[model samples]
Target: MHQTPSRARSASHARPLPWRGLALAVGAAAALILAGQARAQDSGEVTKSHGYNFFGELKYPADYAHFDYVNPDAPKGGEIALAAQGTFDSLNPYSRKGRAAVLSSTIYESLMDGNAPADEYGSMYCVLCESLEYDEGKTYVIFHMRDDVTFSDGTPLTAHDVVFTHNLFLEQGLPSYAIAVKKRITNAEALDDYTVRFDFADDISRRSLIDQVGSTPVFSQKWFEETGARLDEPRLETSPGSGPYTIEDFEVNRRIVYARNPDYWGKDLPVNIGRHNFDRIRVEYFADETAAFEAFKAGEYTFREEGNSRLWATSYDFPAAQRGYVVKEELPDGAPPSNSGFVFNLGREALKDKRVREALALAYNFEWTNESLQYGLFDQRNSFIQGTPLEATGAPSAEEKAFMETLPVEVPDEVMNGEVRMAHTSDSARLNDRRNLRTAMKLLDEAGWTVGADGKRRNANGELLTIEIPVNSSGAAVLESVIETFVQNMQLMGVDAKMEKVDPSQYTNRERDRDYDILFDAYRVFLGVGTGLRQVFGSAEAEFSLFNPAGLASPLVDAIIDKALETSTQADQDTSLRVLDRALRNEFFIVPAWYKANHWVAYWDMYSHPEEIAPYDLGYLDYWWYDAEKAEQLRAAGALR
Candidate 1:
């Protein structure tokens, strides 16, 4: 799932007076002039704040020392080696041309930093800017850039770079992003050497506009111009970034090393304290999960987030683990689980009908697969926003029904009067659930597909009911077993279903081109709703949006998302989201899969973290530190080289 970064901070009603010294009269005159200029910018009173949030007030004060989650005095040194499963040919993650290396974009920095705590939804604190200025109506926003900020190449990061980067993305970034941004922002201009302003469009909701602009990854204008690098193209050369890490070395399909910049401009910033602690981050690539796991056991990589249930349950008893050289831990995760599933390609003619889609979804036996193959480690996912307050549970309330009635599209009776729809259940002992297969067959027959003499279903046009599932090679070890069972069950229902295993590069291209009947991916669910929903579920970009694989374009879904965005209070937003969940469940576009509530992680025992991990993020790469003493102890014991 392409998770949308939430953008926000509480609006300040007024700007604070600047401190004065011996030149008090001069300072007073300057302050009055600034106030007069602010009044001329908008009809409502102008306000200046250090951050912005859409949902509620900011948690940290303007002059706060640092986030409570971080260890401000944590030491920073040593390397943390990790693993990647696929090959990467390009260093640019923003473009769609080639597979981008992991953590490629970490070299760049946004204008503001998003709040990491799970409780502070939609809050953002300033990073590049000293403060943000806007009016009560939020018609426009101005960022007061800090003069001390500089790119890795030591060039001053001025307002001109910010304006240039914004325009660069508008012209060359992904189509979905370009489309959404153009509609929300009217203009981005450099008002001065260290001040930038963005004017908002009057048509759309203004709540996410500040965040939309603030979260923009600012690139060095001078570097881009000097190197003549296009944001849309793939290349190995990287543009100078103002962030802490810089690419040190990389070999295609093998390894990429990122070194922390000793002269990082924001190293001493309050928001950055005790963060970006790794002096070096090394990523080793493997052909598949088996190889990756083997490498982890051999100490080729120091850390691994175990995603394979079988490995977590049965394969962690290697010599290093038994000897206490490795640590296998499950950390608490409070964020909503990812809505992963088998997504139907609605653009395909054979799968477009609602009945056909529903029939395909019923073929997967989640209970049997979870117990028989996955070691019963996951919970079957039912809602797009599963395990959250927004998840629709019982029958719709009177208010929810009334809200649905106002939508432009028709609401199904199941969503209006019945209980919330759930995933089909099956007997855990069987590979093929006869009950579900019978129902699937009946639904397909109703949808005009009949079983032929050859025992394969065919439509009126004599077209075979085919479902092709393309699996990425890197994930084949883990996903193929589950898909194999699903295909058998689907085949038993008279549908010609098969799995196509391909390498990472081919899988990336094929998914982008929508070249399969069914693909496994996730539907991103956000705590705070925003304009980003348009890219995921809106009808406008459904045809070509890379973020939306299902090609889901429904007037009802679009209407509910819009309603959620326009809501004023958190309560109203939750109601609208519940309505959305109900509507999406009724659509039956995705075959619900499974998820776990905690993070399964394994690492060498030389690392340490805060006593309490942040609720939202594991922060392994952010807050976790390398212990020199522990490393020496491990090496002396012949556990690490």
Candidate 2:
């Protein structure tokens, strides 16, 4: 479905957008026209913020509503040196979209901060609203807005704003987060200027918890109305917000400057209690990844948490890494990376045969991909709950067994059903090849495929077995190499496979329409675990056009996701989710690909942090910073010159 034009799903979050997103195109144009020679704050070299210097993650606002996740607890904040690659429009939090939408919120903020898996990782700490209580038998969740909270424009932040933004997003049907928000809220009413109450219709066990605490970010009711633009407009500027940083200067297709909110209302509130400690946070934009990376090396920006490993190995050797200031340390005990894999679009007719699908999964050499192209940089996620607290890792605790029994999810029936767990047989390629070939041969034989004279499998029409995989143009050259290996592996198994290198525009259109036979691309889901997995593998979700590869959703699997979403307890949800995942695994719904184990990144050693260089909880950008003195020193050392 063609989604709305909002710059982001929720102005507060940057759920990954389509590669080469239109929002990115706009942000780039905005960044270029806006650049000018840096001014020394119209004063001499500046230093220190009162008696405290801040560091760690900082904000780089794209607009009033969209902000990048640059942590706040870094070192002494100063003129922020950051870059962007797209337009910084659509600052309103409720209707923002894409990367710039992320930039906007880091400059601004909301009522609560929710970073991850809500079952435990998500906790709603009040930002503008300090105390929240569920009254009227938990039928209505009441929020007490902090009296001191005010928008950057000096208007009081009130309950009306929260209610209005909630309703606004609901009306817009934005992607990335619309369905997530729609599930919980029946009604959001502005009870009064300071107190707002939410009324719900379902027996939502965590109703107050998820809504008031989980993912919903409140916006300024007055500021939005005053701005007089639709929330998703690309021309969005003059965004009214009361964040730790206020928009000091903004150019449509250029850079944005945010001065520290001298009157940041929630500076002492619970969510803002010990964060947002920078004198300024800025976000600039560029056109391409190459431009942005080059600029970072030129000392124009400070950090990049990335996918480009070649550069990290080669680039950071800039003189900065030699000094103590430009420290580079590989973090220890970081959370496991979210699994990145190709989700089979089971909507097509030919892929309906689960046997053919399983055959494809056995063909991918994940070990080879990880070792050669990635230098063993990523981890292989064997389970659905990658990085989640209760993933089926190591072994189950007594607490886990007790937790599993109460929920409606399934425990793998490997022992009972005589099913081979993919995990067990996939430890090595030779073993996988033998096991996978056996499995593939059995499935294909059952599907009416006959063996030819040469011992190659053939369909009913006697054509050599073949499956077409589409590779898009943007990264087609690398994908061509990856697919070439895959084709060779398939050929080794007596299957014919060919790569269709097509324009990304054409490929993406076909993908959205579910028009390809076999495809290679990552279905990158954030928060690797949560309820409603049916959205990805459910039969009913199938009609909603969700990905149910092999079209193999039985009644049991569909019921599990439904129960998990409706259940009151996290344990209950986990049990159901585990069952759902087990069902998916048994069906072989996806050919698993590689995952990132580490966010291999580098800054010119000039980057500084308030906290020591550390990895963030989950994959959120909490362990990044910017340095002005070191940045200037790098500049003085002729890095930029």
Candidate 3:
């Protein structure tokens, strides 16, 4: 699933996008859909299934007890406290007006819930839906809603609310989503109080139609009308939802607590049996990581997901660790690494040239940064889909070249025949490598940015070649230091480069406004690419979509993405994705950075998890249970407050 975009190391509380891996399962209905009229005429009926998987077989059967990765008998009832960097003013996560609190979407539930395993790609089981009906042609889908579901306000959740929520998003949601949804779905009608149907548009690809409608977050229609809530406005008054958690209490910019609903409607459902174990999930806000780490050392929070390599390597020798009150470990992370780096804002005129972007990328030394500042704990990210089979490797195959030949935009020979692009390597012992500096200077000079008498680069118009990386005050100290070193290197190349530090609120607004020349942001990496790519790389949305931080709009990229989404087989998809990766790397929009293959986590000794964690997620907030006896021991030892 595509995670929400965020600054360096900032945790996003927003829910994952629903339509991530919703392609039709291999060999399940492929022939039925591919044969079209012939298959539909032979079998003139739709099938009702308890779950859906677009790419592979469902792991759990209809009558299965629970997921193998979860502890169905896990105990419940204790609080888990984590830290949030930066302040928030709004409780409404749907709007674009204000910064929403972390985990603000915990109170919301979608029509279907996804499986926990990364290997079980695109599998979704019914939650609010008892079963969904779709034909072999896949032109339409009918959701048979469960009658017993209720909102947190004790109101019935029906098909009408689903239709209402979809329509509301169409009118007031993010522009990219609204535009994409309108083109795919032709009509959404409530057939009855307990049944809803969505008809698809004939012009678009039907691969992700079922997933698009199924993942819509269902909200309380009555709550919206009665409370006069606007989905586009910043407001503290939240509409009621049907999820397992509710807003328990809050203090703006200080802390927010979400308590488990004792009377939640779907608590006992098979899909939810082993999840939502915490009685309370509290988030404490801090200005930066330094303060948050000190608070964690003092027992202010119970869990910490360490993102700073320096701290993870050198710190953790506090009294709590010596007393055996905290447990620190590195857990396996099988998911693809995030495509994070210094993204050049294409909206800026100075960065419109590819040569200039490549020059800037050459200036940042990832080798030195990884070894000197990050403790050699990370690997240089080379592709958008790094470490995955879909990642383009050596020279493209003959089939890949043949496929690129048909694209409207010309694929560069370097991309079609050459090895996959990799970040430039430098000496780990020095921040400024003379060879890379000379290359960057030559590239800049050739691009019309020549060094002036004052030893600063300027264009033919005499405008200084300035680059600014706006960062929030809450960014990790090690990361800030890395940026400072990069700025120093850029300065050595006769480019005017500096880090602009701002408060969290201003940083948020500036990022939204696309006010910086270069910004450090991470793009969500997808296991199986889908229509969600439109929001991230499509030319139509690149100008305004917040997800497209670099404002990258390229005709070649748009064409490659379209080709990738139109594939029907896994092999075809992989070929198209390899081509797409080649196309994006050729653009050089982001200067590649470093990523770790595991999750670094530390927590108080009072919590426990299942022996085996799912490959995709840690499930700390979902399945991990609290230990009452261990908590009492910690309290007795005066290790916790």
Clashing residue pairs in all predictions, respectively, total: 5, 50, 3
TM-score list, all predictions: 0.93, 0.71, 0.95
Q: In lDDT terms, how accurate is model 1?
A: 0.80
Top model number, TM-score: 3
In model 2, where is the ten-residue run with the lowest total lDDT? 48-57
Candidate 2, residues 568-612: lDDT per residue as tens digits? 444554554444445555665567666666545454555544343
Q: Between prediction 1 and prediction 3, which has the larger TM-score?
A: 3
How close to the true structure is residue 122 of candidate 2, measured as C-alpha lDDT?
A: 22
Ranking of candidates on lDDT, top first: 3, 1, 2
The weakest ten consecutive residues by lDDT in model 3 span 32-41
Residue pairs with clashing backbones, model 1: 8-52, 8-53, 9-52, 9-53, 10-53
- Number of clashes in model 2? 50
Off by over 4 Å in 3: 1-45, 114-119
